[model samples]
Target: MSVLVVGASAAGLSTVESLRRKGYREPITVLGAEWHLPYDRPPLSKQFLCGDWDEDRTRLRPDTMLSALEAEFVLGDSAVGLDVERRTVHTASGRELQADAVVIATGLRARVLPDQGGLDGVHVLRTLDDAAALRKDLLEASRVVVVGDGVLGAEIAATARKMGLSVTMAGPQAAPLQSQFGPVVAGLLEELHASEGVHLKLGTAVTGLTDEDGRVTGVRLETGEVLPADVVVVALGAVPATDWLADSGLRLDNGVVCDARCRAAEGIYAAGDVARWQHEDSLLRLENRTNATEQAACVAANILGDAQPYRPVPYFWTDQFATKIQVHGRPSEAAEVTVAEGNLDERRFVVHYRRDRRVVAVLGWNMPKQTRLHRHHLVHA
Candidate 1:
């Protein structure tokens, strides 16, 4: 029996590697939509965009190392359809491959702004090519307006400022990262960005774009104000790449709905950003990089009928302007945040997020060990 993984990034690659390591010698095939080998994406907005690291540095594993997985690599070929009834996969390149088991890790595609035509100098970072083009634009750009206040937007805004470009960030929230870090921490982040010379426009929505001769000149705000910019980066989040599974009947909602084991159907499973599995009284779908690897590993075992539930604490981190914010567990549901270690004035502290007087999550600001230590409290909670 062969296993087929749809996606060539961390989750797909992890599934392949885990299966091989588990003594499964069955044939495995990985299908990638991108033309290049699978590379790490976290660096695209940081070291890679800053020119501190090259493309090779973003590789999760060397080509030679991945080649040793003994699986067929179908790079540049996208899986357009899945025939779950016939156990067949259809590719855009006209290849009809049969598989005994199927794994969907299609990940996500960047969300584009409404009514924005393909204007030059307007960019979104997701793929290597996206970063390459944005990097080129950043080096020559004098002023940039970044739309969105999420992790991607904040990171790009920080990177652009570090690149010596004047950056003005338009956030729909009162403070950037308010949804993820809450008001207290988010207010601090807003202040940090201000101190670093990043202009912030809070509670403002981007109305449209100002284009001149097929190039975006600036971004128009809902307030009828325009921020002149040589380039604009849309860091708005993303949607799951589940359009191909529309006819597959795999129960698609925000993503591919799956059981606790990451199983979508008989002999079919999903991992990474595309899988929303049942978790602790709710359906949790994490877009975190660590979740991708962990969920893929669980899916690999569950594919072999191990029956292990894919229960993860949901961990993620972000680095901005030398400040590292690490978080573990479900902080979104927390009603209170307490300083577990260190003081807030130091900007290097660990805070515990509590829900109903119980520790639900932990966040560390430049305190890695403390964050990890508190993560243990929620392991069996």
Candidate 2:
């Protein structure tokens, strides 16, 4: 059967690779909006932004490996519409591709502030091109302000500080990743950033941007104070890229709603950040890199008649300065956190989050092996 995947990122690539590995020798086509080949995105705010890794180094795979897949690579064109019944995808370049089975993996678009558009020196880090532009401005910029306290924003602030620029982080959360890691762990993270020379402007909302002569000068806060900056990077998070499927007759909420099998329709399936599929008794959509490939494998299996449900333990990781943090399962701010291993004061520890005596998540701060071992508790619980 012919298959068409409407994204060329890790999710789309993983589906195709899984199908081939499972001995499905049918024709496959991978469509991508960016002109560049599929690349890793985790390094965009770290290695790529800090000029440690080049564009070529970020590539997911080399030409020789991709050529072995024997799939048509359609790059630099974006999908404008999809015909659900006909299983056809309409592209911006007027190319209509029909396949027996279709997979949606469009991923997400970076969120921006109200006045962020058309403002010079304001940036967002999502794609490779975004990293290149932000890095270029950062090299010449003496002061930089990051407008978010989430993973991306914290990472950007760390990278900029390491690059010797005066950096500041602004967000409504009390600390970086407070919502995800809770007050205790997030408090430690705040201390780490503060010690590294990054200014903390937390627990306050950013009102708007101040610009003079079409160039951004500073970020205005809700309290009427302005954080001066030569460059500003907005890391407020992202939303699913499903505007093109607005009229595709598919259920769209936070993402493309799907069944436990990840099937949105008769022959239409979805995976990765754009898919909100059922997991046990709840609807879940994960935006991390691990879920992309894991969910794609599940989709490929079901497409080949495996008929297994997709239930994965959510995973995500981030690197800042000399720290590498890895998390498994869902950790909420409301959950009770307990240190399961090591010592938090030493900056190498593993913490477990629990609700009603049931462990909900595990986190590792500079302790990868022990953290992974603790994840088994989540699986067995």
**Most TM-score-accurate candidate:** 2
Give the per-residue lDDT of model 2 (tens digit) for 288-338.
Answer: 999999999999999898898998999999999999999999999999999
lDDT of each: 0.89, 0.96
Quote each prediction's TM-score: 0.98, 0.99
**lDDT score for residue 171 of model 2:** 100
lDDT of 2: 0.96
Q: How high a TM-score does candidate 2 get?
A: 0.99
- Model 1: per-residue Cα lDDT over 269-337, one tens digit each: 999999999996888899989988999999989877699998888899999898999988867522588
Candidate 1 residue pairs in clash (backbone atoms < 3 Å): none
Worst 10 residues of 1 by lDDT: 329-338
